[model samples]
Target chain A: MSSVHFDQVYKRYENGHEAMRHVTFQVNRGEFVFITGHSGAGKSTLLKLIMLMERPTRGQIFVDGKNLKSIGSRAMPYFRRSIGVVFQDHQLIPDRTVFDNIALPLIISGYPDKDIGRRVRAALDKVGLLKKENYYPIALSGGEQQRVGIARAVINKPTLLLADEPTGNLDPELSNEIMELFMRFNRAGVTVLIASHDRSLVQALNYRTLQLEHGSLIEEEVVA
Target chain B: MKMASPLDEKAAPSPLPTERHKSFGRGVRNMDVVWRDKINAYLRAHRYELVRSLRTLLSAPFSSVITILVIAIAIFLPIALVIIVNNIQLLGGNWDGRPKMTVYLQLDASENAILTAKQTVLALPGVESVNYIPADQALEEFKRHSGFVDILYELDENPLPAVLVVVPDKIGLSNDGSKVLLRQIETLAIVDSVQYDLGWVHRLNSFMALANRFIVVVTLLFSVGAILVVGNTVRLGIENRRREIIVGKLVGATHSFVRRPFLYLGVWYGLGGGLVAWLMAELGLFALSGPMVELAALYQANFQLQGFGLINSALMLVCSGLLGWLGAWLTVAHHLDEIEPL
Candidate 1:
């Protein structure tokens, strides 16, 4: 079954600016896809739509066969657990340690202490930040901070991963490093969807790519 | 760069698995096990959040102290007034548990008139018994005590009138009953005047009623003040941790989870304030104890300032805590929604 299905989704803000227009797409389970668009191309808004943070003005969204519109505010948190999200600004809580930041999702889902420790450590290792668990995000470099963000996004072992500009601050080398990490999780049966405009990396990686322009999907290409 | 395999392939345990999620429960996971784990998880989160919230307050000692001190003072004032009112009630009670009425007859009343008056008084309702002191006998007793026996012999006749000390029945000792009986006895033709100290009882009764109303109003005002004090404090706390709350909500924290720590912070505030209020009550009682003892000595009575009982202290803590919780809940419910991550 498809993990994400958007059917004729249209999103318009109250200010009359259209963020998405009649967009339709489907992501198969365990697929790695990148949403590439220039700034204001509605890439972030698309991720928000899938996350149900912003509702589409018209259209339906289904995540893992469950209709998002039917989910109430109380159920929104639980629904979000099936998906992981990383942000462009690396929204890691500055006051907390790297370990605590990653442990947040697990803690929200009420994971046992032992399970939290193992999973947090494994996720840190997955992002190659295992030794920096005790350090604060401020002490880490831009690449390292985004890695912490990634570690947190997947700590709960979500089936679907959604990242918006996950490497917007990183250099080409670190961007590739982050993209490769998403590939690893995808290979492990976790569907990954990253919204980034780094064309060199998007063209270089072997995944389905959806390119958006002027609030509409203009290109659908599969990289070899 | 080439894609690598996942770091660890071992699946992490699923905390809540659906009944038909057979693959997750393959070996050791079962319905009963899952239920137990969920319950355990809930308890652990509750415990951790409770302690963590308390630590948050303790970490900021000066501000916490001021907040708690304000709450304590609010609680203490009403309770102190309550204590003062209670002591006054006790003092008023000792004035006269059962006062008597005195009837003075005309000095020139004949023996037959005295006899008729005695018989008439005995027949009245609520008149338990009456003692008749004739004029000459009253003058003799007064002369012995007044050291005026020689002076009394110089007078033409005894100036003292026949006095009838009337004791009322138990029913007559109550508020309105005493007044009714006094009126009935005063209308007698032979009686010159009727006197009873029930006036003091009536005044004391009204004073007590007024005091009770004052206490209720005062307690209500102070309780609301305490709640607002706690509410404002929690509001500041929510503002300070606004970022943390946003992150928590973004990462899938339920509203309750975001609210738990603030609720606990309010509880700690209540706890400290309640205990401090109790402390202030004891201290206030202690400070006044010396004067109380001296006053009681002058009255030849043994009166001690009543300290708070154990149950009262416990109730104070619980009530203050509840107010604190309510205050936190109000603020959190009001502010947490505005904190959703964009």
Candidate 2:
């Protein structure tokens, strides 16, 4: 069964400008999918719809087969808990230590105190950041900060991970490293959907790709 | 899939559920998570923000002290005024047990006739004590006490009229019985006029009323000013941490999650300011009490100065808390939405 399904989805801003039109797609369980297009092609809007950050103007979205339209605001947080989101800007809280940042999801979920410490360490270790746990995000390199962001995303071991250009700010080598990290998470059975515009990176990965142009999904391909 | 090991089995390990079930369970779990860690971390991360806001306020010692002093001064003015009015009202000197009316006889009345009039006045209701001063005795006493003996010897006839001093038995002499008794005394044939300071009593009552209204208006104005001060402080805090709030929201922090610490900060400010205000008011009253007592002694009266009582202190504390909360609420509600992760 699909983990996320967008069926004839549409999103319009309050100014009455339609950002997305009849966008239909499905991402199956454990799938690694990429959404790529030019700026303003509704890539971020698509991620936002999936995150339920913005409600669609029309049509329906199903996350893990539960209709997004029916989810109340009180229940939205719970929906968000199962999904890990990484932004292009790597929005790490600069004031917090890397460890605290990674432990946030666990803390929000109210894992036992001991379990939080254990899982946070494990998540940081997985991102090769176990040694830098005490460092604040401000003191970290861009790649390290991005890794910390990734660590924070996966600490709760979410079933679906959404990366909105997870490596947008990194060099090619670091981007590949970040992609590899996503792959590792996918291998551990987490479904992954990444939104990126890097053509070379898209060609390098043999996965399902959805192309968008002016709010419409123009094409799809399996590079492999 | 590999079969579970003994340890794994003991841990209750199972295959990954279908995506639908996992997401549903996760949604429920996320609700629990957001409140648990994110809210708390937001508070911990923003501790410095609150302290810095307070420190910023305190950095200008002159302004800080002046601000607090201004509030205290405003609060003290009406309170002190009320205290003075209260003492002035007491100056009529324990009228409860000493309700007395003086009746003067006509100039042509004889001393025997005046004494008979006094006995009749004393028989009236609420007439507890009575003393009759014959015209001759009145004149002699005036000469002795008024320090006008040389002037008195130059007078050909005794000028003083016969006087009847009547004290009432009622605790409050303003009762209807006293009024009736006064009217009755006025009707006596030998009595020329009955003298009492009813106008002073009415003036004291009106002054007390005016003092109460003044306290209400002054308290309201000062409270509004306090809220404005606290609101401005919270506004600066929100501006200083604008970027941090954006980052938090982008990383999935909810609105309440971002707003909680500022609320607590406001509470702390109110609590602290309330304590300081109470202390300042009390100290003011303490310093003024000695002078108030000395002034009362000059009039040969015993009047005690009343400080901000426990009830007033409690009220100030509650007012401080409300002001702080209101200030923070206004600031956060106005600015938090403008700060978006986008």
Candidate 3:
């Protein structure tokens, strides 16, 4: 079964500009897909649609084969629990420590105290920030902050991970390191989709890449 | 195939998938968290956030206390006024039983004519009893009772008018029946005039009515003022934590989850203020009781000050709780939206 599918989806802004036009794509279970396009190529718009953050102007989106259009506002939280989202800006709560930021998804998913602690520690350890558990986001470096964001997104062990410009602010070395982390997670049966404009980074990963231009899919290529 | 352990068969701890259903069974689910583990996890994870919010509130204890005191005073003032007015009404002395009317007879009327007039008035509606006094007998009784015996002897002739003391039935004294009887007695030929000072009774009734209306108006004004006071306090609290709130929302905290602590804080403020106000009112009454009793004794009255009753106390507490809740709701509804996760 496909983990995330967008069928003829379109997202038009209020100001008469179409951000995504007739976008159709599917990511298979446990597969890693890269979305590469220019700034206005509707990369973030696509990720937002999958997360149900923005509604499509037309057509349907199926996350784990369930149409998002039919889900009510009350049921949105349940849907959000099945998918994890990581933003380029690394939106970690400044007041909370690294451990707390990672434990957010588990907390929202209602994991038990013991399980949350065990899973949060494990997630932090996976991100190589176990020693900085007590450090707040403000104290962390940019790459470290992004890792914290990634840890929080995956803490609940969601079936799908959606990363929007996960390495946009990192150096090339850190970017490759982050990509390697995503590859490791993908190998462990978590489907991953990343939106980015870094051509070299996309080429280095050699994953299935879908290219968009001016809100429409222009090409699909497999670098390998 | 791997062997399934007995533990695995029974591992499904909950039959219901949703926490909302569990809430119905246990009656103790945190609205923010679904299961006990979730609550514990959230708390353990967000201990810093919780401590920071609490510490920020505690840092300005004096200002918060003053605000709470103002609210308490506002709430207590009207309630105290209500009790005072109620007690005053009770003390004005309900004269339902004693209805006396002094009837003056014509000076030239003969004793037999005066006696007949008294008998006629006594037979009228609501007339319970009557006593007749001849002009000569009246003068003699005035001389003995008024301490004017020497002056009475100096008079050339008896100057006292014959009078009839009329006492009406208890029901007649308080209702329209007594007024009707007064009209009938005035029409008697030998009677000069019939008088009952209804002015005092009328004044008391009007005063009580005015007091009730005043209490209602004052209470309404104070209730609105209480809401504004609490709203302003919550607004300040939100302002202080604006950054924290934005971060919480960005990190996937729902609006209600972010709002719960503020709501609790508001309730706490209200309860504390209400308790303080009740204490202040009770102390004020206790202090005034001594002087009020002494004054009542001077008037040979059995008046006693009534203290705050249970119903009034409960009402005060409820008002406090509502004010707190209302204030928090107003602040949350208005300000929480302004904070965006973006």
DockQ of 2: 0.25
lDDT per residue as tens, model 3, B235-325: 8888877766755554445455567567666776677678888999889989999999898766555678897799979888987988877
Error of 3 at B186 (Å): 6.0
Worst 10 residues of 2 chain A by lDDT: A104-113
* Predicted structure 1, TM vs. truth: 0.85
Which residue pairs show backbone clashes in model 2? A78-B27, A79-B27, A107-B37, A108-B33, A109-B33
Of candidates 3 and 2, the better by DockQ:
2
**Against the true structure, whose TM-score is highest?**
1
Q: Give the winner by lDDT: 1 or 3.
A: 1
lDDT of 3 at B2: 26
The collision pairs in model 3 are none
* CAPRI-style quality class for the chain A–B interface of candidate 2: acceptable
Top-lDDT structure, candidate number = 1
- lDDT at B13 for candidate 3? 18
Where model 3 places Cα greater than 4 Å from the true spot, the runs are A106-115, B1-56, B93-177, B185-199, B239-255, B297-304, B337-342
Residue B221 in candidate 2 has what lDDT?
Answer: 78
lDDT of each: 0.83, 0.73, 0.77
User: Each model's TM-score, in the order given?
Assistant: 0.85, 0.75, 0.75
**Interface root-mean-square deviation, candidate 1:** 4.0
lDDT of 2 at B9: 14
